[model samples]
Target: MTTITTRTVEYPADGLTMTGHLALPAGVGRRPAVLVGPEGPGLSDVERRRADALAELGYVALAFDVHGGRYLDDIEEMLARCMPLLADPDRMRGIGHAALDVLCTEPRTDPGRIAAIGYGTGGAIALELGRDGVDLRAIGTVNALTTGRAGEAARIRCPVWAGVGSEDPIMPPAQRDAFTAEMQAAGVDWRLVVYGGALHAFHHPPVDQAVRPGVGHHPEHARRAWRDVVGLLAECLPVTQ
Candidate 1:
């Protein structure tokens, strides 16, 4: 069995006590940390699986709750709930900063070996953290539905990797092209990988709900993305384990 210890973290933000899960790998020394932001499903089971998987790989992974306890049954409601947080740059930055503080303040975390990864709306949060100059070692995002603010990309000092599907209607190839150009122009070390036929929420497996459309699980793609994420983290963050 893999050695993993789970802890509950309370983030005091917006006067709300959001509950989050922190999984730590066993060791006596400080370890590289990854702050994972959950997707629109509102920190579903899959994200906990992701945190456990990362912990099994010998990293201290913290999956933070940005939506508090509010979960939406429909896509429209999820978007509506997340819009204000994303629109208000300060709130978006604050949310990510709070997660960072949790990770950095942890006794098992190596302050210098910190990174972040997010998906969908969480992807926007990851980008926001990078743009806010969080001193992260690396950053990763999946299907960034919302773009960062003006000049935010230029503020990112770490290597950034973005994975998106070519057939994603939410973020078309044209927009991906434009975003890639903007990153290049800003001199940010960035890369964009477009999966040939994958759609939005590609990382999440299909659920029993009948309301979700254009959502399907691609385990192969998910595995590939994990490899890329692990490689990026290892390259950027110090090997503290």
Candidate 2:
């Protein structure tokens, strides 16, 4: 196994002191960087492990925080904060840009080559960054099929890939259609994969805390989604040896 390094990084975003996880690949020389966004519940060990996995693949990865350093185990509290934030594009962009700035400033990151991959609310932020005209190599989102303001998606300069569970009530067929319609209207390169029989947040591992209705983990689909995102990165942002 390739040796990788990990650290905790503190940065300010959305008026909160965010603590993120940064993972570096072995023997890196300004490697391509990736931004990993957490779900609405906030950053967890799940996201940190993903950053480490990406680092092992020779990419510098940072798993950014959403609720300062706290993880919201209560579903109601998570929605209370995420609902309003999701409705505001500017706020999402601010958070994304803050994390991007930290990633760019890292000595191991190649600023010119970066991709944003996020889950849930974090996924929405990644899409917001694309809509805000960030020069990203690619954008990958899971279970956050949000549509931007009218005609704003045209600002997205990179290809986008999204994954969602077919049975996700939060992102039902109607919502997915709306999101895809917006992407199509903007002429953005986008793809959506619906995992059959999976529920909302299907990619997440089983949690000990009580989850919202229609939120469940599908271990098989979760692995598939990870491979799909990694495949998206390999195709759009190849790492040079």
Candidate 3:
């Protein structure tokens, strides 16, 4: 097993004191970095574990925070806070840039080789960063096929990969089509993968029961999605030992 280190990092975002989790690989040299965005509620064990997994793959990973470290367990509260925030592209960019700034500040991070990936609302934030013209190596989103303002997606300089469950009511087929259309119209390199028979947030583990009506876990799809993103990182941003 590869030895890794983890720590808490405090940063500012969306007018709150945001706290994020950072994980680094075992060795000594600078490495490619990844920004891991959390779901709508906020940063939690799932994203932190993802950072650890990225570290195991020899990259520095930072799991960004939303809601200032608060995880909204109530569906109504989560929607009330995230829905409007997600609708605003500028606010999402603010959150993403704030975390990106922190990641770039780390000496261990190779600023030239960075990628962003997220789940749910976090996924929207990653896409926002791409649209805002950040020089990312890749953008990967799971369970978030959200579309952006029509002309802005042209700023994306890297290939984007989005995954969503076929049965996802939240991000249904129309939404996926719209997202892909926007990407194609902008001439951005992009790919979409629809996991069959899965529901919203299908990549999530079956640890939370307080989910929306159509949300459920498909462990197999979750593993496959992880492998897909890992493969993306390997292709776009390789770290040499």
Candidate 4:
């Protein structure tokens, strides 16, 4: 196993002191970096572990925070905070950019070689960053097939890859179509994968908290999605040994 380092980082976003997890690879020189976004409930051990996994793969990774170090396990509470935030594109961009700033500031990060990968609300934030004209090599999202303001997607300069469960009510066929339409109209290179028989947030491991309908885990699909995301990164932001 690669010898990696991890730490907690604090940064301000959306009027909150966001505490994120930063993971550094084993080797010395600056390496490609990736921004890992968590589900709407907020950052958890899941995302932090993903950051560590990315670090083990030789990339500097930062799993960003959305709720100021709090994890909302209640479905209603999660929606209460995420709904309004999702409605405002600028707010999402603010959070994404803040995390990007922290990632870029790391001495080991290759600022120019970066990609964004996120789940649920975090996925939406990644798409928002792409729409905001951020220079990203790639954008990979799962369970967040959100459409942006008209013409905004045209600003996205990188290839985008998205994954969703076919049975995900939150991101149903209509939402997926709309998202794809927007990306197509903008002429952005993009791809979408539908995991059959899966539900919303299928990539996430089972949690003890109560979840809304159409939210469950599929261990197999979860592994597949991670492989897909890793493949996307390898193609767009390869790490040098």
Candidate 5:
């Protein structure tokens, strides 16, 4: 059985207490870990499952909670909590860096080889973490709207793999093109994929049914995107175990 572990860590920012999950390969010794930033406002069973899935693939994974202990039950509430953080930008960086600290300091993680993956808003945080010169080896983002922006693209320090849906209204073709241009201009190592006919939150299969019509999810695209993300991580942050 893969050895999965979890704990609650306080992110001294805003006196927030976050409950996080860490999963490691069975018989591991300082395995590389992926610090997973939550989509917005918190951690969910889906995030935990992603961590477990990463462990199953021979890497340690830790999913951090951004919502403290408050879980939003609807889009309105979720957006309310996420808007301010996205607007401030610094709060996004602070929270992402703080989560990274919690993941790297753990004994089971290899400080030299940790990376990050995020979805939607969390993806933005992961990209920010990469741009902030954190010691990340790779970054994977799914259905991210913010990655294509100019200022953030300039700060990335490692290889980036961004997956977006062909039909995603939030991150349409124009935005993807712009983001591609920005990455090229920044001279950052990067890859971009637009899954045909897919929609937003492509990798999030169990997204609230209420969110389905608003944000489509395609299991095939999600799986493909995940495989691509894991492959990129393996290439950029090899597991030393």
Candidate 6:
């Protein structure tokens, strides 16, 4: 197993003191970095584990915070905060950039070789970072295919990979169509993978906590989707020894 270190970090964003979890592979000069965003609920053990997994692959990883360090167990609360924020691109950019800045500040991070990936609301924030024209190597999002304001052109320069569950009601066909159209119109090198018979948040493991309707976990698709995400990252931001 690779040696890795992790710690909690506090930073400001969206008028809140956002807390982030950073993971680094042991014994490293500057390395490619990845910014991970958790689901709408907030940063949890899952996101941190993703960061650790990235560290194991020899990339400096930062799992960013949302909702002021509070995990929204209540679906209503999650919607209340996420709905409005999703409508506001500028706010999402602010949140994404704040974490990006923190990730860049790490000595082990090769700032120019960074990728962003997220789940749920965090996925939307990742997409916003791409649309906001951040110089990311790649953008990978799962279960957050929500479209931006109409007529606003997306300025994503890097390749983008987005995965969605076919049965995800929140990101149904219409939303996927819109997202694809936007990406195509922007002339981005983008691919969308749809997992059959999976629901929203299929990438996430089953939780005992309250889950909104139409949300379920699929172990098989989850694994495959992760492989695709890693492939995208390896293609765009290869980790060097």
Candidate 6: stretches off by over 4 Å: 150-154
What is the per-residue lDDT of model 6 for residues 1-241, given as tens digits with 9 covering 90 to 100? Answer: 9999999999999999999999999886999999999998899898899999999999999999988888887888888998898889999989999999999999999988999999988999998888777899999999988677654436788998999999999899999999999888878898999999999999898555665689998999999998998899999999887
Each model's Cα RMSD:
1.7, 0.7, 0.9, 0.7, 2.1, 1.2
For model 3, the stretches where C-alpha displacement exceeds 4 angstroms are none
TM-score between model 5 and native: 0.90
List candidate 2 stretches off by more than 4 Å: none
Reference-based TM-score of each model? 0.93, 0.99, 0.98, 0.99, 0.90, 0.97
Give lDDT tens digits, candidate 2, residues 50-153: 99999999999999999999999887898899999999999999999999999999999999999999999999999999999999999999999999899999
Q: Clashing pairs in model 3?
A: none
Model 3 alpha-carbon miss at residue 168, Å = 0.1
lDDT of 1 by residue, 97-210 (tens): 887889889898888888899887777888888888888889888887456677777888899899987678878878797778778877999988877678887777755465
lDDT (0 to 1) per candidate: 0.79, 0.96, 0.93, 0.96, 0.77, 0.90
Q: Which pairs clash in model 4?
A: none
Q: Kindly list the per-residue Cα lDDT of model 5 for residues 72-130, writing each as its tens digit.
A: 75878888978777766678788887778877787877888888899877888888777
Candidate 3, residue 14: how far the Cα is off, in Å: 0.4
Q: What is the lDDT of candidate 6?
A: 0.90
